[model samples]
Target: MPTIASSNFPTPKSWDEFEDICLSVIKVKCKSTNFNRYGRAGQKQNGVDITGKDHFGFSIGVQCKNTLNLLTEKIIEDEIVKAESFAPRLSTLYIATTRPPDAPLQSFIQKI
Candidate 1:
């Protein structure tokens, strides 16, 4: 795979399309990625966009944010908190954003 900084992945046309890309990525990276029933935009999603079991059968939650603006600490933190309240619970929470996390945000996530 190409380095994330220089990845050739095409930009998604919309937020929903970005979520689909994230789901596809999760499927390729794992073996059991599943899109939530409420994954569609404008749905009453409880926070998670995708859910799946890891190789160890641990549930994982994915939230995708497709935006050109840089991510903020508050946004990332909020997503983490929301994922925590999702049903069935998740062993991990992932935020797939168009822009990579800044250093501070990355550190914060690593410390979680």
Candidate 2:
């Protein structure tokens, strides 16, 4: 995980903050896996959070949700489908969230 700058302590309170957290996570994971990290540009019409590319030149998409409730598998499935529609060549798709998803949702992510 990217170290939260000391000046940036305290949990995020908004969608943009949540998006920043997800982007940080993605950057760290990509770097650790030897993949290049690109930042999110804008929100998708269907609310996808970020879009970029990995080291292998494969397009990547990330959707972020910050909520207290556990995420549903349908949300993940829908985000993946939406991302595919936006970037058909995407090799990796992720629905990143602040709250850990429920068991079934986690399993769905694992399968993806």
lDDT of each: 0.75, 0.64
Counted clashes in each candidate structure? 0, 0
State every prediction's TM-score relative to the real structure: 0.81, 0.68
Worst window of 10 by summed lDDT in candidate 1:
32-41
lDDT of 2 at 65: 75
Candidate 1 local lDDT, 38-74, one digit each (tens):
4565775566888888777888888788875767778
After superposing candidate 1 on the true structure, give the runs of residues whose Cα lies further than 4 Å from its correct spot.
1-5, 33-37
Looking at model 2, the pairs that clash are none
User: Model 2, 1-112: lDDT tens per residue?
Assistant: 6564433445569877888777777766665343322334562444356656666656676777777575677776776676667744667777776663378667767877
